[model samples]
Target: MLQGAGVVSLSGISTGAYATGIEPFRQVVTRYAIRPNPAAPWPAGLRLRIAVLTDIHACDPWMSLERIAGIVAATNALQADLVVLVGDFMVGQRYVTRIIPAAEWAPVLGGLAAPLGVHAVLGNHDWWEDPDALRRGGGPTASGTELTRNGIRVLSNEAVPLATRAGPVWLAGLEDQLALLPVRRRTGRGRLGLHDLAATLKAVPDGAPMILLAHEPDIFAQVPARVALTLSGHTHGGQVRLFGWSPVVPSRYPGRYAYGHVRERSDLVISGGLGLSIAPIRLGVPPEIVVVELGAEAVA
Candidate 1:
């Protein structure tokens, strides 16, 4: 009887783990309304709804093409003014998960719609596959042609002017710094400096509110106060958190910038992301579609 009881107890434990840890990948939308500091020079009374989707390792086992479609559908339903994809479209190396070609998933990504249009930056995985391929399109890079064909602009160390009701805001995108490293040497926590962040900022006209799209949140340190906000994803909220604490955060400053809104030199929002990496299970921290409402009081 004791042995039978132990089996039942073990089964319960497994069930609980699946419920708390792995089940959060169902894709929950987390909404936030951020009011730019009144003191800042942002255009007054201008409200911009920005939807952010990131870290979509659209491969098999965990993330499938259908899942990607569902995520896009949900984002579209949000009726955002601007939509930004922060990268990591493909799964990283050293994982045993099923591999899906980028072409198969590109059209689905192309389908994402927003009034201001869709913009993206390449993630480490996309860079790891082939940097050249990622830029010009083709190869296994998930974002290239598929995104461009669908009208999603891929920003690589460049800035574009977006006219908002408040005023003209500049959107700048940075290249994946981790792509500069040798694939075998990437530990996921290493510092990335390949992209010229300063140069990207310089392209933006002075006094215009700027929004930066970077894949990793660690770059928050370098952002100046002039840039109103920075959006990023890479840590995945440590992928697993226990009692609100993440045991492993793929970042240099795990304690401070692992997830959520962090204020350094400027305001930063680190999304937990919509897909998984390294493993198929997520605990405590759920997959998220971050809906950020700008020019309003901050709320979660």
Candidate 2:
């Protein structure tokens, strides 16, 4: 029997190398054809092809500048209509040879091309890791400020409608649900959330199809039937998964939020994410570039 930390090593480090060294550096695009809840009814003929990259815990040895650039190039090659980043741009772990500053990674991500434009949201780590942001309990976080400075649109609990070839659709991005870490508050037991789903959805006009960008899948519980789909990444497939089952997910839903497509009151697709957090490792689940195709599979 595997003893001591051998099992942990096997599940985390042995594969962690790939999570850190190999797979994440590669552009492994996984495509999904969203099937709307018949009862909820997605707008007919409103197709959208979106490229999603999330949890890019950009560090030196794990996720270098060169790696991010390559991923950007690969995503551009997909020719997606819109590219959405689901947050956690800053480094997520402490096992790094060196820390890559936002200034270094932001410009590289600015190269991402999409007709509808590149949009982003903040993640829990983006707030938890930044002292000033954690103290202020809000932006301008490094990921938010730097990403915006580089010209990538960072959405904070706001929605915008984009004109697509299929039709016009509203795209909303929620503020990170766990945006504030209560490190300063002695009595608070959990992190605070800034996400306002109701206010954000208010921006969507009636009769318009909508897509929401959220950092954590747990928020799906609060998501209503109005949203055709919700995209998120944070659990990193529980940072190690086997046969579509992740044992240590970071959400209240645990196993239910493992990875892949979730069909509930609102449809949610949680990407395995591109980088690891807490450690430089990812097991059965490799990094991925999620390509979500809406409507009649408009993406060729």
TM-score, every prediction = 0.87, 0.89
**Candidate that scores best on TM-score:** 2
- Measure candidate 2: CA RMSD: 3.6
> What lDDT would candidate 1 get against the real structure?
0.81
Candidate 2 lDDT tens digits, 1-300: 568678877776666567556765555788898766655546666667899999998998888899899899999999999999999988888998888888899999999989999999999888877889777667788888889999899999899888876577788999987776556365476557888988998888876778899999998988888788899999988877877777789898996876888888878899989887987767778789999887654222
Model 2 alpha-carbon miss at residue 231, Å: 0.2
State the lDDT of candidate 1 residue by residue for 145-252, as single tens digits: 567777789888899989776668889998876764553354544434457798899999888888999998878888888887899999989988888799999988
Shift of residue 295 alpha carbon in model 2, Å: 1.0
